[model samples]
Target: MIRKFLLAALLASATTAQAHEVWIERDGTGPARIYLGEPGEPVPEGGDPEFAKLKAPKLINHNGAALVRKAGYLEVAVPAGDVRAWDDAVFEPWGEAGKKESVVYYARAGRSETRAAMPFEIAPVTAHGDRFVVLRDGKPVAGARVTVITPDKWSKGFIADASGVLRVPVREKGRYLLSATQKDEGAIAHPSGTLAALHRIATTSFVVE
Candidate 1:
């Protein structure tokens, strides 16, 4: 019968080339077995069976806490700290990928909480030497909103104490292009927005010289 209709059209094109990415393995002492779907690209060399098909979903934080998911993607669990706030509910999909779907969000903590969100440091102002100090995970990110562009001058705002850190008081140092921003308080969700569609928010940036 024409090879049974070409074997059902190659199994319907491998089930429509299945997609829905996001996978991470390491489940034992701290829970880390997140998977979504179409998980078929470098995840098949163990118990085989196509690595059991891939579906995983029963997220149980248990105190290794921090698993936000509104727009999707953000899985902390280990010392769990850094992750200030950005928007997108905090991340938690499992399927129905968006952000231009083709999903691929995976995480497996440990190693001091994955180095505790390090990214924001520009120290170099030994006593008002034009000024420059913007540490993040190492502390000192007050107000947080610095922008220093110089072709002639264009400095701009914030960072003065809340522990997010920022301190750029320059007056004449030249060669500047520093940038920093922080304005993600749940991003934009209004059912009375404060974070409720599952909640998630984390935004951090760097680049100072």
Candidate 2:
């Protein structure tokens, strides 16, 4: 209960150290659209971290393409074969608006089935559907917020249990974006003041038909 309260406090904090979910969504073999901010809201046009800032989301495919994230959106070139992709990185800390903090963003999107074991990553534990497990440091992350975004731009939020497990019913028939976040209450010094750091992980998007 106490930990749940702390997670809520972290999400509801009124600082630039805001909790956010980022994902790359592709529609029918078309260009990918990267989204930032809370789910269900329209993807913003600016003020988003770029590939250089997010430490570059890695894409494993032919030629080992040079990918980039920009304008709160990233255009990805999908190769002509099954692929596994992921961008799991921690960025340099920044401060502003009387808040100091750091961000860790990670996401996976592709056709490959082998889900890489990642620190602070989300994995599908069920044979199918929207069930998943939230992992941090290779362990379960309980009481995390797992939000889902449908291709129609509608979204609903869900929570994980003590085992960091979540099962969200599939309600749409296009594409799906699953995301969750965790906070590290232990803070560090900053020019503005002491700040609490937050870590967020993006799911290797699942689909429902």
Candidate 3:
């Protein structure tokens, strides 16, 4: 019974770490505006809707120009060319046991999409159809679970192959989010004890008509 309880506790911890996802929510599109958030039921029930509570998130153009905007949520417009946005690292430390850190990103490819300029990042190594790759410190991360979400919260999960590439079929194509959660066995040692740290990253993109 004690062993079973420990197993359940471990599973619960892992699930909590996997819950962080970064995705884009499109509002109106006269010039094409997008909001960022973790797609969930709604706010107040653990939903951080519409880029709520984030600092001045910015949209960067391919030419290295950046536009900073402010709001209760993050809203930005992609330029006529390639653009991308990334979040500051959000770290969650639970007890002396360990910590879980995640960074979320969104990119609108102008020509071709490759690895993002993030330390622990995930991006599309292929077209936005289905295949993607997860990278930690800019290297392929195998064994990460990439959760694919379609409209209405329809979700399917895929595992990264040895090359850290994921291939999952896109059914219809509206808005999609691909999230990856990875946990390594290394932890930072504090004065308290050895603290375990898990790394997770996610990306959101879409297929347009």
Prediction RMSDs, each to the true structure: 19.7, 7.7, 6.4
Each candidate structure's count of clashing pairs: 22, 0, 1
lDDT by residue (106-177, candidate 2, tens digit) is: 665533342434566677765454667777877787888888777787778888999988886667687667
Cα lDDT for residue 44, model 3?
Answer: 34
Higher-scoring candidate on lDDT, 2 or 3: 2
RMSD of 3: 6.4
Q: What TM-score does candidate 2 get on C-alpha atoms?
A: 0.64
Instruction: List per-prediction Cα lDDT, in the order shown.
Output: 0.34, 0.59, 0.52
TM-score of each: 0.19, 0.64, 0.62
Candidate 2: where are CA atoms >4 Å away? 1-19, 28-33, 44-55, 58-63, 68-72, 78-92, 95-99, 110-116, 187-196
Comparing 1 with 3 on lDDT, the higher-scoring candidate is 3
Best by TM-score: 2
Candidate 3's displacement at residue 50, Å, is 9.8
Q: Which ten residues in a row have the lowest lDDT in candidate 2?
A: 81-90
Which residue pairs in candidate 2 have backbone atoms (N, alpha carbon, C) closer than 3 angstroms, thus clashing? none
lDDT of 3 by residue, 67-127 (tens): 3444423345544433455554332344323443333343332213674665555677764
* Candidate 1 C-alpha lDDT tens digits along 1-209: 99778668655533432333333333234433333332223334343232233333323234334554321223435433222212221122221112111111222222212232333333433432335445554666666554544424454555555644445544443333344433323234343233311211112221222
Candidate number of the best lDDT: 2
True lDDT of residue 94, candidate 1: 22
